[model samples]
Target: MQSLFFKIFLWFCVIVVLVGVSIETSSILANYYETRWQGVLHTIMPMEAEKCARMYETSGKQAVQNYLDDLQRQKSVRFYFFDEDGNPLLDRSAPEVVQKMALNKEGLNRIAQQNLSAVNPRQGIAMRLVPGPSGRKYNLAFQQSPTLIMPVSEAVGTHPYYRLLGIGLFGALLCFLLTRNITKPIVRLRSAASEIAAGRLKTRVAPSVRRRYDEIGALGRDFDLMAEQIEALVAAQRDLLGDVSHELRSPLARLIVALGLLRQASPEEAPEYLSRIGQEADRLDKLIGQLLTLTRIESGVESTQREKFDLTNLVQEVAADGDFEARAHAREVRVVSADACTMSGAPEILRSAIENVVRNAIRHTPAETAVELTLKQTDDPKKPGALLRVRDHGSGVPERLLSDIFVPFHRVEGGAAGNSQGAGLGLAIAERIVRMHNGSIRARNAPDGGLIVEMELPTSWA
Candidate 1:
């Protein structure tokens, strides 16, 4: 009753079982009545007919009447008889009975036929006594008293009550089991949904593979899809914010530095200051352009045009650019190639990312220090990739902050002294561009000296 499915099933089972029991009970009552009627016809009726016959032959009419009267007192029975001409010879109770018998021509004819037949013919007892013989020569008609009908009614009524009660109990038990089976899956789905609502984005309803292909399985599948979509959207939003912030930081830093220089200069030095400001402005413009390129790449707006490209050539070009700034810082930039490496990606973006890494190494090293850039290819088929390593032997980064060094605007302690002109976004921008090309970049302290940054680009052609 506590569950809707249970209540409905219970009602249905009750109706079906009750109907079945009612039919069965009715059949049983009918069979019992038939048996009881047969007993009365075969045993009691025959015995009464024989008794009437004996009285008619031995003791005559007065003895017959006395015997019938005695039977009527003991049991609810009536008796009568007629002679061969179909005239009433002996009748109990009243003289009017003989006259009433004479009026019924069909009764008299049936009685006369029973007496005339050579073989004895038995008739079944009935609720109403029609005009018929009592299956004996002397007795013309007989019937049980009206009170005997009560037993048949009693048999039908009592048996149905027990059958209906049994049906009700069985239906209730079946309903409880059915309701529990259906609600268990619903409860699991509710719990899974609640967990997801509470920010457990990975939560999923366990699929019941054995269950039927019904509404419950559909709901579970839909819930899994919803949770997956929510997780994807949340992840995309976070990446968007991080990319935007990193892109804007470089240009803004250059502009700020340009303004600071202008504020601390004289009119005679205006030309020199203006030249520096122009250079910074150009740097800002270049930064903005690179940011737009990175944005388009990361957002999947621009499809990568991949082709076999020489990795060593790309690294040499990036090294040449870094060398230009390295010369100004009095640093020696060297490119060491171990083997000819090849890869497939948008060359422009890969070049930019590689250039950023080399530039950062050049900017952070000490004067006259050797900043080595090495390019190599590995033989691993599962990891067919080009490895680019840039190492700078200068004041190394703190071990504790090494992991966060690639984060945008995350400047370490040594960063302030060595790379004063940088906005701390180079490594961050490089990592994003590399990841957009399905590559990875990492920075770690070199065993011998300063920081070593490594970039790996997969070269799998298949």
Candidate 2:
């Protein structure tokens, strides 16, 4: 009973068995009463008695005797023919219980005078008196299997108990099938849960369970979603740790070398060595700042102050700053086109994200090659957002690593080989910012052989 399968199955089985038993018992009792009632036996005796009396009146005792003998052998009914007096014409031994009933004058009077039927103290025996031809009365008695009867086992095969047993077995089998159908999916879910708890985040319920059109199906779907989210979080955590450690090691090694140089150099050359040390320290500081910004954005710790702002103005401003800075290396930044498009989001964060992408382009594009910015208002049904494109005229990233270029600590093989001053967190931070505004960013090799970065920001958050 502690188990649901057993509880439900057993209850169903018991109910069905009880109903079957009740029906079989009622049928058996009805049949037993039908066979034993004196009225049932009497209903047929009058007709039979009349037939015998007519045969005796027309012919002799031989015809009537033949019918009596055949009836006794086939139906176990004994006939006693008598006149107005209490004298039996045919000699036949009465059963002892019936003999005693005959001695009760009051009972005999009730039977003969009222033409009623009666039973003796013993079961399976009944008596009735019927009027014969020529005013003669016949005493009729019927005994159920008096001397000849089938064996108990042979008779039981057709008894109600046998039918009841068959019905009970069928009910039990049906209950077992029903229980299995209900519990199988639950058991599978439990097993999957156990596997996931053991750190197997990919473990999931079988397709059969998920296909169910019930509450269990919904539960299975939820479990699968949870497992997928957990797997993604764990993978991201591992990647973050690996990237952080690898990025820190470079600056730390440089700082050690700078310190060693400061100690070995003469006092007159201390300023130059000290400058090298400060550069390494600045590199470490920038790396740590970028890592913190990425962490805050990814973890949702930094609350965004969303407000409506003109995106076209912001891009122009970022391009202007980038242009003034890129002039140092003879690289230029200019907007090729602009459209007044407004969006709702944290203006500061968006400014940072756009500035990073533009600066990265300026840093990579070859000298005297102006980094072009195009702000186009799109109405395409599939995109339905503003597309901001930044193109740098430099050796584009390899086709294989185009997707990974935005990953933190992931730099192209030779995209920035000549200039190794900036850390590789610019594009990664840009991607995070774009995602926070419910937007998307992607990079590809432009048709004219330069790297192009496109950022799409939705006009509406919903």
Candidate 3:
């Protein structure tokens, strides 16, 4: 009773059975009455009575008796005869009730009025008269025993009760199958939901169920989407905790060492130790700030503050600042090309994202090398977006590790740019910000031997 499948199946069965029984009961009663009455009237039709009367006179009493007996055995009817003077022709005794009936003027007239057919208490009798060659009148009576009506022995087809049983069985089977089809998808959704509740976040309903074009199908698809979101959120939370722990350990350790040095150092060396401690504190503060920014972006707490602005100018400003900083290391940051692309977004957030990439490029490229920036309007009519590419002439990332470069705290190991120290939240935060703007970001090795980062934002944001 608790199972949805069983409940639907049983309810369908009850409805089918009730309807089938009602139909069969009414049909059987109607058929039985219609067939019985029609056959009863046919048996004692006036034409049949006349034919039997003629035979009785021509074939004589004995032969007529034999014919009547055959009719009685086949059609369940019997015959009685009397002379015109009211004398019995064949002395076969009939029941007293039939004798009384034949002698009564009212009963006889009633039978004649109906063409010699009449219904008594239990049976129907039909009678007729015929004339001999000498014009002598003879009276004839047809009677049935046990009941007045004759039963039709040769009725066609199976009995009505059996037919009803067959119809009920077929309806029950159809209902059972229909219920299974209706509830199968629900059963699968239930199982998947149970698994998910039991901590199996990856569980999902079958794809076929989701493809069904119905309300249940829509529910299944929506459930899968919810589960995916939950899984992503859980993973991001774990990654954030791990990233914070790893990134804080180095700065904290430097602070501890600086503190020990301050305790023993003379005044001349004390300032340097204090400065080192202050720098470590600054690094820790910066790391915490980056972590908070990443958390806000990843968790969607920081809603997009969109406004119209020129993305080209944003890129130029970031590149210009990077160029000023790169001069200290004999490196250059240059805007190779620019396009006039007006956009809508949180300008400050985009500025930070773009500036991080530009500075990182300048920080990693070899002294005397240049970091190149390009901005262009995408031509695709459907997308109508802007693209920004940042490339550095440093050694390109390893092919296998390129995919992991944007992961928070990820650093390229033993590459030409590996000498620089970074907490590695820049690209990760940049990617999140790009996605928030309904954009995409990716990194690849340039053909001329460097790393290239491309970012695209659609025109809807413009």
Candidate 4:
């Protein structure tokens, strides 16, 4: 793929060259016509032919013919002469034009009315009529300006085509060179990103071109800053996990050893001690597993392999697993779905997230209360998404603690009063997993009197 900077530079150069060439070509053509008009005016004399006729003893046809020939040789000029009756006495235009004008009476009348000094300035042709040797006779002189007669097509010939070809070839070469110069740093940045994605946390874009003070240089600086931050955060997280694990390991090992010793001392006390030890071990194991899962997700070591799956099946499975736990608390867990729903994401992660919500509901609800697990697909066809909700008919979470419910290790004061079985990482992990799939999880108190945990997952197939 091409870099953004190179594309922008290419478009900029194209616009600049096009506008420059257009203005230049227009100016050149205008100046050419202007200079030719000035030259033609300098060479020809503007006088009434009647005045010339009164002064001259002989016919002035040869002198006017010679002037017309000289101007025609430089460019292209047509000349014509008419009498008092508007008859062409002397015509030196091409044979075709002479024949056409001979048969045109209207043209002859227009020429008579135009008479000598009366000429349209904008038109290329100029005319002057004078009295001949007799008062009844006249000399109508017609001279076309060289500027308007010269054809641009013939003037350019082949030189302009060759010049344009050369310019286009040179421009392409310049664009290639510029694109290379701009994309070199981008290529380096891309390679560094690939390396980082491949697990090389130290990979970074070089700042060797910082002195250039361009977009590339700015990008290099930004890339380096981003790399540094990622490295620091990763290192700090690893260190914190390591320290927390080490601190927990000692006490956990000691408790297991103490329980073994108690079992050896009294066979009757063994059952109770063994059960307590099992509970402690389960708690420690859950905490360690949660920490590792959180770390993997946070460090980007684990990515969700999103794919379409039946939301109904996932909700049913999670609710089934949490049913026994709800039964132990004398609460009934019901999985209700009015319609089949489909969602996209890592199925295992999504299952875990839903299971956590169901487990939380079951743990918080009072005895004989019902913990409802509902799956609903949105009605809007354009906005296709599945909502998995777990609602418990118990003293719901307070308004103040609702916002912090999804935060890691944050347990509600009254919610966790009776239950010490969890380390309060379930909702946090659920939230992280949901967000990884580009979904959202929220907790709120239902108006009917219970806390509802809703998870919304987007799906392509509604």
Candidate with maximal lDDT: 2
Candidate 1 structure quality by residue, lDDT tens digits, 148-257? 43454444555667545655676667676666657887888889889988989998888682243556666778888898998987886687568657756665676677
lDDT of 3 by residue, 10-49 (tens): 8787777877676765465546645664565555545555
Structure candidate 2, residue pairs in collision: none
- Ten residues in sequence with the least summed lDDT for candidate 3: 148-157
Tens-place lDDT per residue, model 2, 1-462, is 335456566777776776677566556644555554545555666666567667767776777777778888886656554333434445566666655554454565577687666664234556555566676655555555542222232233347576566556766777777678678989999999999999998899999988876677778888899999988989988987987898889989988998998999999999998998898899999899988988889887654678888888999999999999999999999999987778888888889899989888888899989999999878775655789999999888888788887887777767731237767788899999999999999998887778899999976322
Worst 10 residues of 4 by lDDT: 149-158
Candidate 3 overall lDDT versus native:
0.75
Model 4 residue 200 lDDT score:
90
Q: What is the number of residue pairs that collide in model 2?
A: 0
Off by over 4 Å in 2: 1-198, 380-384, 416-419, 460-462
Error in Å for residue 378 of model 3: 0.9
Worst 10 residues of 1 by lDDT: 119-128
Off by over 4 Å in 3: 1-36, 39-198, 206-211, 415-420, 460-462
Candidate numbers sorted by TM-score from highest down: 3, 2, 4, 1
lDDT of each: 0.66, 0.76, 0.75, 0.67
lDDT of 4: 0.67
Go through the candidates in order and give the C-alpha RMSD of each one to the true structure. Answer: 13.1, 8.7, 9.0, 13.9
